[model samples]
Target: MTASLPVATQQDGTYPRPQLMRGAWHPLDGQWDFAFRDDPREAPAGVDFDDTIVVPFPPESPASGIGDTGYHLVAWYRRRVTAEDIADAGAAGTGARVMIRFGAVDWAADVWVNGTHLGSHTGGQTPFSIDATDVLDRDGDNELVVRAVDDPHDVAVLRGKQDWLEEPHAIWYHRTTGIWQPVWLEVVPETHVESLAWSSDVPNGSVTLELTLDARPADELDATVELRIAGELLARTNVRLLDRTTEITLHLARQRNGQQYEHLLWNPETPRLIDATITLGRGASEVDAVSSYLGLRSVQATDRRFLLNGRPLYLRSVLAQNYWPESHLAAPDAAALRREVQLILDLGFNAARVHQKAEDPRFLYWADRLGLMIWGETASAYEFSERAIAALTTEWMALVRRDRSHPSIVAWVPLNESWGVQHIASDARQQAFSRSISDLTRSLDGSRPVISNDGWEHAGSDIWTVHDYEADPEILAHRYGSTAAITELFDGFGPAGRRISVGQQDGGQPVMLTEFGGVSYIDQDVEGAWGYSSASDAQDFARRVGGIVGAVRAATPLAGFCYTQLTDTGQETNGLVRADRSPKIPIEDLRRIIAGD
Candidate 1:
């Protein structure tokens, strides 16, 4: 019920698709009739629409009005689409196609429009759509129904931090079964731009634009793209669209004029985004247009260093669960997503290692504009099997394709702590799975470093990372202060008693203490809340964080370190900030310690 807000009262505001934005789209994020049953074999004939829930928020979330956390395999939702809904999308009156886009639905989703089967989608973390023009009841109201299926006990599914047990336990929390992201409608011209893929070449002062259209182009069809930086025209070109997809490179005028291209580069210090506009037309009149942007940035994993813009950049990062008490996995609002990014940077961390979640695009939008770096990660199935491979592989690929253009994302962690492949250290099949994911990620996006498995047991990785929670500063300093010690440790069982590498250490890759300093501190009583270490007071907490973080910073051979976490989630009280995002200590003091100053 609290999903929609007036267009004002916001900054850069939230839009489902930030990259390809058109002004004529309509939001479908109000209310929907919901049920928890499978009585309907196909569409519209549901057993009952007993409850009304807010769109986008999952039924397990309090914002959804159901707040049901129990295990359920299926959830049904119903709503009515009216003429005003189509009219509000101003572009649909003529030869336009109305597409209903669902930002995400957990596990599996079968949708229907006006009782017509629109087919099903099998992923939980990526966007899918249905061209509903054919099935729309233009003369009257149209009924929209969705049936979502998610098995809580299915270990082969990508559950992320969602607990499969009856109650939340360990680091896992409650499950988000169905309809956890946005649903909206956009009216596109019959020959509109379907997708945009952007990549920047800082060295060449140019950007490569790959565009896909909704249909085959006519003989005289033309597409024009404009690039700008700081309101100054950077590049513009009009290319002929002979096929449905076309690629064009736009070289910036600043680079062509022998000006300093450094000012145009995007980094944490000055996050410069080159704005762009794409237009499709037959001759003079514009058929379709959308505004987009890309950042001129580069990231690399050099031996013993992490490079940003070809400069050695030490990553000060924190693991982000990104869960809210009221909203669970789906962010509470657009402003909340922006606030989380600001909080991470305010604590002196340059990057967020978003653990177990492929973050919302709105979060990436703010990070791209605010100069915060992100290590994008996704959920892993608990077991290694054929089902696990299919589910994880399909979802992960779609996720990568959906997010590869963002400038803030510098790395990808396909698997973490060997969660899905627990026996990867020895099992050949499991090891192959890890390698395949790494290889697949590189094939899709080779611009960012791919960590096959983050903590230990790296089958194929561009960075050698390990998670060690040793509380004593001196012990951690001595353990990782030298390269010889790290190499020796990699030869045997690591801090977690898992093999660090399969055969070789993949020398020349940067080494980092990726997870450490999980010092728990809380002023209030909360049972079962714990961390790797505990502190009694705010001063004690600061001292513990400074000690642990400083130890890793003092390791001369290591590239960087990511502290335990950012905010507390459920029973994990190891956050610099509380569950409600309140700082435990003075913000300045915490920033000083995290910055290793």
Candidate 2:
């Protein structure tokens, strides 16, 4: 039997984009026609969708209302869009652009509007959009069809923790097929903001904003970018749009008195955000405007310690996979996402290592607003192939571009436990590939640290991270307590029985115990639930947990630690809370243990 669903209300049906908000939007997130095809060659247009599945929830999820745990190579979804959905457009239907946006669809997605193929997207973790303005029928209804193909065994596809077998096992869970995130319709002007990338230098008191605009070659455009803090205009500038992308750097370094502006830095304790706006204009006529927000923060590592906003900080984080017993990978709603973050913070964790999956943007938005540090990670494919490398590289670039602006994200984890490149230490090509991806991530955004391969056999990682499930507190402390012990443990053999250091050594880089202490606490009713080690009862679990956490906290050389998980996932009974987000141990006790009280 599955766990009970969380009693949280759905999001207020607002646009999913919190960083960049548009005035008008239509969320397509209720119910949709769903069909599963055995043959991968099946086309969505030819099939008559007979079954109904909830939007934004995978077919395997109980919340989808079609709980088919079996592998489905191809899945199709059909929905109708009426002109009323885009009626809020600028000119009712004349020269108005209606963009169809999908927060994410697993594996690969082929979209069609009004029987016309708009485009296709391959990445499952990043958002994509298509301008359906030309194909939209303003007077009547339009058919929207999506064909999603997901093959968990195919190493070319980044499947995260999705189990390749027919049933869930170990750390891998059920497959998330079809649209796993929100779908919506947005109306935009001809020359609206496509995307924005923000980079801040808190020490220098400056921020560089890059804007990518959706414009035609014929439309000449200029933009006025303004930075505001509580209604006061901090900086304003204008630039000619000679190209589709333009960047401007706002230096808030000096005041009229030749003194530096006292900048507010963002951290888990204080996540202050500054408002921003970009207005596109043609000569003197304003064509389009978009609103956004940013936070000023910087992350750096020196002397084997992490420095957030120029102050040394220890990361007390949890391994958050963002899975639900009812919805699988999808949250019940936006409020559920916020609740999860609040839960993490309430448990005395200032940060979370969002393991494997590239989480929904709404979670990151809340993390930014509510002050939670996130280690942005990419889903990994198990096998290393030309196709796998291409898929991972493409999706990781898009993921970085999509999430780099958020101040809550302090690091980018490209791979986990050498899942895709397992033989990196022995294989020359795999080692090169690992370094290439690391270099590429740094090139994309140099502001944050990059963990090339998180768990072990590190190739080119900014932070030395290891995963150990040793239940004995003495053994755990002996493994990573001192610099000499760390060097011996990492330099001799790795945690996963592989060679510890590959390309980089355990230099002065900060060392983090990314995974450990998956102590199991199974309810008597829940069969097949297990963790790394079993606990007899709540008292036993608390004693073991306190022992492990106290040992890690006393470790002088270790920079931080992330417990095995925040909540229980399918078959994994190692969560601090159960699958339904109910606490196993007392909240106060768990918080004290995690906080080293």
Q: What C-alpha lDDT values do all the predictions have?
A: 0.86, 0.84
Ten consecutive residues with minimal summed lDDT in candidate 1?
1-10
List RMSD in Å for every model shown.
3.2, 4.9
Q: What TM value does model 1 have?
A: 0.96
Provide the global lDDT of candidate 2 against the true structure. 0.84
Best by TM-score: 1
TM-score of each: 0.96, 0.95
On lDDT, the leading prediction is: 1
* lDDT by residue for model 2 (1-597), tens: 001211011123245766676556788888889899866666665797899999999999989999999978889999888878777533443355788899999978989888888999998898999889888887799989999988867877898989989898888899899899999988777667888888987766788998887754356778887777666677888887887778888876343332434346678887877777777788987777777788888898767898898788999999998999889999987789989999999999999998889999889888888899999998899899989999999999999999999999999999888899988889989988888999999999999888888888888888888899999999988888888998786667866697757868656888889999999997656657888998999999999988998999889898888898899888888999998899998898899999866
